[model samples]
Target: MTLNRRAFIGTGVAAAAALRAPMVWSQGRPRVVVVGGGAGGATVARYLAKDSQGQIDVTLVEPTRHYYTCFFSNLYIGGFRDIASIGHSYGKLAAEYGINVVHDWAVGVDRDAKTVTLAGGAVLPYDRLVLSPGIDFVDGSVPGWDVTVQNKMPHAYKAGSQSELLKAQIEAMPQGGRFAMVAPPNPYRCPPGPYERISMVAHLLTQVNPTAKILLVDPKDKYSKQALFEEGWAKHYPGMVERIGPDFGGDKVEVRADAMEVVIDGTVEKVDVCNVIPGQKAGRICEMAGITDGNWAPVTGYTMQSRIDGTIYVLGDATAQGDMPKSGYSANSQAKVAAMAIRGELLGSSVFPAKFSNTCWSLIAPEDGVKVGAAYEPTDEKIASVSSFVSQTGEDAALRKQTYEESLGWYAGITSDMFG
Candidate 1:
């Protein structure tokens, strides 16, 4: 089937009907409740609705009416794109795909009862549950950093208001104002996100305020694209962006929100703007459900079914997929595999091994983009390495433009795959 954007977005109701009609005509359809409307949940819901053909009832529970993607949020920060461009409405999933999308927060999951409870007191019973609620902050990681403090020093990781807050701060700052970014530790969502954000912000500063400086405080010594990012920063915004790694005393910095100061090795550094991305763990719902031991839920790789509760499948940033960073691309890919597995299981068919792929793009400049990608196959007990690729360094204008084009294509393809 050739799926275009309009057709894809418009098929939500049809997809839902296919799933519903089969069940109504035959024995009962298996109910699948997806908690989250982000990359993982959205993809699974759309695919299940489209492919299940009334054999499965898919209901996606997400609190947001519109989703703002972190994938290209940096473009908004760079003034290259508007926030609306990155925003997506769920109307397609509701009207065309026939997928029931509930705009409410899921409070708890009653695994024994196979029920998901919303904060508004709605109880949704399901034969299978898909949890992809994403990550929450890890408390105590940064001194004096919490939900209250986040308002003052926004992370902007979740996008929306936080993104606007940071952009406003950048715009209001003096020509030489210090813009500090505190990146989180590893195993967090979107590994390349922080670096890309810094690049885009720096790109903006170069045009608006030549003397503006960016201080990157990273806990780890290495990052997603260390060499490439550094090269871009130095070549484009020379002496404007300074990155401090763990080896250079970056990990010792302490954040104080009330005073709006960061202390590095007992030296206080005042900044006009602060973007602090804290350590992350599984979403609160996972904790409330008692499915997670620490920050993430353990899941069977083959089925994405929770180790603690077999009936519940966890995807996206909520589940611990060993070695896989919590990324939107990863979440979307995992969701498809999980959806297929669930379909087979519900149909009393043997589950087959799954393969997954991810391609993450980073825009360094308005026209210059870089990317890293990987394709994987399952091995005994875990998904093993397969193949990976990264954009070659240097000023290849053609390749740079190609990367940008590919990035947009990916957005279209993935969105269509999910909503169509």
Candidate 2:
């Protein structure tokens, strides 16, 4: 579907006017404070800034100056794409969209007072708040795993420093060195990410060090697009990639980076490099705001508003949206819905019924890509499946190439939609 810039701006103006009559309109614009400038938060901030036309003041709080997506990060490791190609700047959001980009961490939240406190002891009041802080690692989920040992074994899940660390390790490994990966549990960001990472890294090893081997330690026996990934690995990497599932001795894996050894079952193995993707939970801000239950923030599916707080809405990987996977595409789609919902509520207009769509692409090789997508609608209290799509299995060679091209186009388009 084509993006309607004019219609979007028109909707925003009408919503703002409806919220406050011209006679009662104050000199100051309504304040909207957003935390996390990732996929979800960036989209919301851009749309609101573009549409509101100075009627709304948007303040985005994020510590990063640039965002590097995890989707195509494996390409960087494979030396097929440069890191700059996948990185985006917040300059457009600030200069063009009129968003105030604050480079600071959100330390606390006062829900009753509608104020957010930063690490520097400054409190910013907001008429509305949007949070998409992404995911944080779950402590003790994997024994002997924490931030202290992260340098020895990087997660690379957040797609910046860790990603660079992993790439450097791969390049420094000697010929015939072993590369091991520990996959996270199900329902993590990007369901097919771990397998795709293995594919790209294996591809790199085959060219640079053909004798090198890869060990995949997975907690689950099944995974998203398992059959397709396995087919590609077998066809391209052959025995170079060995996958061990839970039923097949994968559950007994243990790591000791200080000792430079990993134990699988009864055997202690040494590896030249290791990449561990850990299980995740909601960011700390969600917990501080009292919106999280366990590791996720519960939200109303229709509005993406927190179940515990009316003025606050949570989206992205940090929120529990039932069946929707915590993916960038999903987060972007959900942010638009939440933006519309907030507009409706503040403006006293009829809320539009929410419909969401997501398309996630995984690269199996430099020129080959596989994608899985779904269209969703709110059913009862949570999101329900409307339709789903996946790339054809054993398809023509040209189709795979086309999918790769499409993935690149999507990346460009989505980035533009978010920051441009």
Candidate 3:
């Protein structure tokens, strides 16, 4: 039967009543294992621990102790913020919220056994498994780029080390040198991310090497905030940024990381640095769990539960939820909904209708920001956008600065929400 909000809540209430007491007392509180530690996983872990009041045993699995946010990594590259600013520690989740934060790679998930195998030779048993492992690059999406040659091409899409490497490369570029970016196609993590990185790269190059040029080799015909970015590029860094679309064979391309050259439509162009943002799919762990439909894990938006297995939930960039973009803000929003639904099912708590919202902010230049956002509600089919807004092309400077300031506030608020 199709599980809509009412049916889900009704069944949950009945099952929770019968199973809650035995599960809690006999099993020593229902165990919840959350894999991943970024915006979605971290937020869900924190919320489950915070709201459950010790009735749930929450454990978070992540490989990195210091989680680097992909959302604002561009600003770090542009020198608006430092790398440390974008990095967050899982200490608060352990210390403050009483979550068992395991710093280990989750290698496998056994759904039948309800156990997760870690790389360090430990297994975790869970009553509910939340897989929010985020995105992993699709193999050979970019013809000549992979993790082995990442040091040379440097996707820098994951933030932290890659961001530092890309920034260092931009700084070390000789005068009038060329920088190339092979942008990913649609349905990748962070729709506006590549464009924002382009703007930030231009910002940095304009300051250090004014004569340097940027080539955006994009497979998409258009990108998020195209007009705003185009206008800003012309006004702030004129004749510096150039974009090649599919019409011009931008989609037909390959890179030579060894030679630092890009081959576009049989035309080889030498570049000083190449940033290859490749096509992406849900994190590998999702596939290992046998929960993915194609590249993404399909979930019921009403509760973020995997369509294949009701015991498993997926969130963030790894999910195939409709309408919402694969962004940090979107992930954070989805996490809350999942947390609420899980609590209702496990603890017999009240279940409320699911709602979600997201806002994507892009900085074109210093204090020049544009935004797009929407409110969403879960339908039988998907999470549908109910209302939306976007910054106009010719917005005033004061307004743009206000938008930028707003983004800073959101970053602080979200990081606190996720970590604490």
Candidate 4:
């Protein structure tokens, strides 16, 4: 979210006391309602309730009993991690953090009324609202492909049973079989997600079916950490993977679920496995709240508050913030900022200068990883990058291994930050 200046936005001395109105319940404490318990929502809710002690009434509205993170899901697909390792429960947030974790979909957001309508038939009032619903695919981004036929050509973007389905399809592939991936375009969740998934698939195929071929149908001419990934693919996987860019009919592609075929450049090919990741936008909840600019929620980077409605904040993949990619780390970082601002407004808490940082690490092969990250600050326009670093194309093995270990540590740290 862009503001007049990328700076910490306080409700100010005058507005802070007056901020509490019909938004607060008669119970006593100021209430904060968080939607979509992923990286952003979970972290915000936990921090608000934990730091505020018993002052702030925090409620997290989530639909799943267990959340399967999309961050380490590639490791699950590559056999480096198990599904249970990436899955987390909200029990800790409820019992330990004292957050009222409600397992139900937030069906509608009444910004004017400052209430969230849940599918389970409850109206939740909030002094502030945080929405971090993640991403939803764009219809017709890949022709003949939608949620209806998600089984035949699995996207596995949401990281649940879809991930299991894709892995099963990969294991079922015959030796020397063809595997096709329909990659998404730019500005999608996790800029490096599709490529990391390809790396994982290649890792699995090398072990199970070394002779198998991977077809990457990519709309972009290049992608995040392209050099590092391509080098690793050539060194480790050899000629097993081939890429089709937009210049070479990557964009002109379609899938046929009924025929089990893929058409690239008008050439029909029958593949044993298909992983179709279509173009993505913000999750449906943002659009339903009428706070989205077509694809993402515009917010004030200073506080992560919605530009359309200051009382509401947006985070993670659903927000169109500056510089940072749609990463779990970025969302977690933004959540802390929003949590501080919301507390400052509600509880007269100390407000520090807002600053944000993010790092996205990706694994290419066993003990081989690459990363791209930056420190960011608010500009009058958006959150802009300050200093950044990335893995070199031909890094030493020890450094790569260190990077891989760093990613594992980050996974543990961030999940703990969100859940605990």
Candidate 5:
């Protein structure tokens, strides 16, 4: 099926029954405690609550009152959008959908008790647990860089304050100062994110500090939309960006936050600003729950259910599902499938065959956007891609502008779908 906004909405509806009846619960209403109010968790919570029609008790646990989406964060950095524009609140989810919105951190998960312990010392019990904790950086992933030193060399991967920090640092750069980025390896959240960031940074620098230079040290030999970004950078901001791949010691790199220097191979280059996007793993809570395999949580694509524990489901950037990139769109799509499966198991609702889709849009420059996406289905082994599409090179200006506008519409639509 072609998965668009309307098609996505259709996935959230359950097949009609001639005589609808609420399932009887032994211990009050069936409880679903969703940790992380993101694309996955929020969408799942909303769908479960809305589709179940008051049969399932849904609670969302998120520490922050306002969620800043990482998807459009690059635009914020590039001055295309304000921070408030990307920030969403759970008010509608609570007021309209009757969801229990708890602003607290989920500190621990007890698999045996099927309970989640919050940092504020409250324990939440649940018949079903949904984990969509986006991502956390791997410790020592980049030498001399950690959360303590993030103020010196910001990652800005989580959006919000970090994005503000990076943008401010860029704007404050000397006319001809150098800015550097230590891009993450494969299997990172938003495969095209770091590159899009480069494009956005270039866009920012060209207007304010035209002479400034960007040094991108990437471990990967190739990146998402490589040709498109390269073409845009060349066409829009020529002589402003340089890239170092693994052949030139990009893989073997380190950062010195105090000195504001990047050590590529044996060479140390001082930079005005450094954005260090380190290797990533599933949110720490998955490990705490003993549901993670190595750096990620493994789940069945059919229901987004944990391979380790069926009672739990993992979504979004946290899952080790195959084929699908770790993206907000991917998580939102998966949430609907998981929500349907959970409802079916709990309320005997009709569950359709799981269909997943994701499209990643990157703004190359002003009105220059490129995208790649695919439709997916659950096989016995994994979520396999059946078909795909991408923005091609040499596209006319009109089409590129249209792609950028399409992304804006998608951002508005998906955030509404997730929060409302």
Candidate 6:
């Protein structure tokens, strides 16, 4: 209920005889195949099955049994949360909702045949396809970095073992050592993620290696919650964090994973630990579906349907929806709208106007939280923002603590919404 402005579940019984004849349920019943089990795919799968009762068949195709959310992995890295706390399982979505959850990889999509090919060679026929496979890194965006070298300079972007790897590496750093972070380019998932990671790293270093220094090699001049983060850094841990922007060779950077060196402005420096978050694109499944326009899938603002293929809807970080940041909350919101539209098409359910809302909260230090959010609706061309709000600079302790507490509640609520 707390996220009701962004999520809605509709139910109504109207005789198909009174409405459009084409919308009547077929005898065999329509089948919906959802690829990926992140916020978007999971929420839509649950809603479509639960709201429709037994009117349709829902199958969720996801490779992972337990999903670790990328949203709060930074907090886990910071030691505020344990790894088990952020992990969720798909058992509830299967048993409780009567969904056919398939633990397999969706290798190919046959658009003409309306079927999906799984890794196990089973073919699933679907009336509607929902793809929300999340993000994949652009090849060679970080010089001298690839999947082969991820263990050395882990991105820790995907959560789980990578996050634990990064945490152990950071803790193993020597006293007064240098830790470097090569931030990603614009239009990446979780705009505030890297900065939050920095805050968490700082929080850990302040207690362990008080003399350690953190150097951020950032392409962007400014980051989300810039003023507030800077204020907290200066107040809590001064002289420990430094940012090198593009103007000072932040954009011109490279890494040598084998040698553990970072090249900034043609100057190579040895580092104790390196975190290279590469530029991202839509997940590989999107490309396989032949719906991606460049690195992302272009979608209509009103409904998350692919502009290239109307029968297939794309959601979350994989979509190129205007103005909406590729966050878990945004994906969940988009899934509801797409679910409503899909239900209306197959089950003759009533459709409502599409609306979405999102909020991204970050912790600078313990009990010190900051946020930015907006409510949006479809425009002629994009998902335009109607209104926005952000945490003010130099806020009192009480409000910041309250915000952090609210974020904890949200994390609990959202994971339940997605998994259960």
- lDDT for every model? 0.81, 0.82, 0.90, 0.87, 0.92, 0.88
**Model 4 reaches what TM-score against the true structure?**
0.94
Model 2 regions more than 4 Å off: 1-27
How are the candidates ranked when ordered by lDDT, highest leading?
A: 5, 3, 6, 4, 2, 1
Model 2: pairs clashing at backbone N, Cα or C within 3 Å: none
Which candidate ranks first by lDDT, i.e. highest? 5
Better of 1 and 2 by TM-score: 2
**Per-residue lDDT for 275-302 in model 5, tens only?**
9999999999999999998899999999
Pairwise lDDT winner, candidates 1 and 3 = 3
What TM-score does structure 6 among the candidates reach?
0.95
Which scores higher on lDDT, 2 or 6?
A: 6
Q: List the candidates' TM-scores in order.
A: 0.92, 0.93, 0.95, 0.94, 0.97, 0.95
lDDT of 2 by residue, 93-194 (tens): 999988999989999999989999999787989988999999899887667678889899889998988888998898788999999998998668888889
Query: Which pairs in model 3 have colliding backbones?
Result: none
lDDT of model 5 at position 374:
96
The pairs that clash in candidate 4 are: 1-299, 6-379
- For model 5, the superposed segments whose C-alpha errors exceed 4 Å read 1-22
What C-alpha root-mean-square deviation, in Å, does candidate 4 show against the real structure?
Answer: 5.5
